[model samples]
Target: MADTISTKQIIKPENLVHKKSAVMTDTTMHYCPGCGHGTTHQILAEVIEELGIQENTIGITPVGCSVFMYNYLNIDMQEAAHGRAPALATAIKRLMPDKYVFTYQGDGDLAAIGTAETIHSCNRGENILIIFINNGIYGMTGGQMAPTTIVGMKSSTTPYGRDVSLMGNPLKMTDIVATLPGTYYVTRQSVHKPGNVRKMKKAIHKAFEYQKKKKGTCFIEVVSNCPSGWRMTPVESNKWMEENMLPFYPLGDFKVPEE
Candidate 1:
């Protein structure tokens, strides 16, 4: 008999390539290599898959680095004007109570320009999830000063460091949102490290669960890294977030409504 080669010996193209995480697709993300947005996006996608809400979820993309978020998440999404994601999410959730609604917003979009929308949405007890990304500077706007910019941090606009006297201190959205009776769950987490990433996933899951219960607004503020805006390499950006940002914005659940 002729020599027979084992079928197993044949290399499979799929096997040769590394397996991609279920949470993320093979599509190349536009975020900077070290940008925290990619990590947070993965976590959110994982949570959606785990909860089996991907089909029923609708995400609102705000005008920021995440304006292209709809391109990444394989779910129904709508683009909202700058800082208007909360208002759009509110209307969507109100109309489609059976569907899951969420808004992905940045510091400048949420804390500065959309402050009114964010506050009113939370105050009105809107049943939606708000994923607020606070990276201290405006990533998409050429590193401009943001409402959440830490005191003494320098940005393109604040070339000489953030002046608390003239610009005001960093706004703590999680703390402010938690105070609203309409808010069902409020947490602040980060993606600077593996441990923190795990915690952030938990917080994201919890926010979704709260929405499932039709409780009220659930807000999760993620202290993310903006390497391009921060003018640091991806590795250094993560490290900087840990050393300088975490102290001001600790990661943990700020509030959870009682059953």
Candidate 2:
């Protein structure tokens, strides 16, 4: 007995849209709606493309929302343990001096578990660029309290607002990292508004440029919005960042090396 049958084709997920821009690749991002990580990823990719460093660039991703950054940015990337992106970046840059090395990390991954790694890497004057995303909570692990969680901001761990007496005040990582003598460039920018996004792109470009020139460490902290964790609509989250976060983490260039 012979039987003939036709199988229906499966449709791909709608979220898997191909990016027309050369900077972004054809891949689906796992970020929640209105998340800022996608915006930051695009800016970084655009900067890398504009500077023509994709071939020579190496990205170190940490264990956070950005852990899958390699899938978005069409470049060489290596995954590192939580908060160890900076340390891994240092080693990579040291081994391959000609390569453009950068680390993409979140607030919890950088300011908390990776605090020592971040500080020591900066102190060593490693030729690397650090893209620090300070969203104020541990986005990947159910929005728990992070080292940068502002006082009075409630998280999974700090259900009744962050208690300074128990949890301590938020750590200003940009200011702290800027104090290291080896750091060549340091800036804090936001991704909420279009104007600020443009400024952030410029800052990212400068950081990559410094790394390309082997000018030492360049650290950029992007004050991002976490709408889901903040329990607000995307629009409201942006407003919250402008109103509350900006005052505590003022946006500006902390340091720039002599030309």
lDDT of each: 0.88, 0.88
lDDT of 2 by residue, 1-259 (tens): 5475443322345544434348678898989889999889988887888888889999999999888888988999999987899888888888999999999999989999999999999988898999899999999888999989888988999999999999878899999989999899999998888898889989988888787777888999999999888888999999998898889999999997776
TM-score of each: 0.90, 0.91
lDDT of 2 at 259: 68
Q: Write the per-residue lDDT of candidate 1 for residues 1-259, one digit (tens) a residue.
A: 6598676865677656433446455678899888889888888888888898888999999998988888788889999988999999999998999999999998989998999999999999999999999999889979999888888888999999999889988889889999999999998888878898888888888888778889999998999989999899999888888888889988788997777
Model 2, CA-based lDDT: 0.88
For residue 218, model 1's alpha carbon misses the true position, in angstroms, by: 0.3
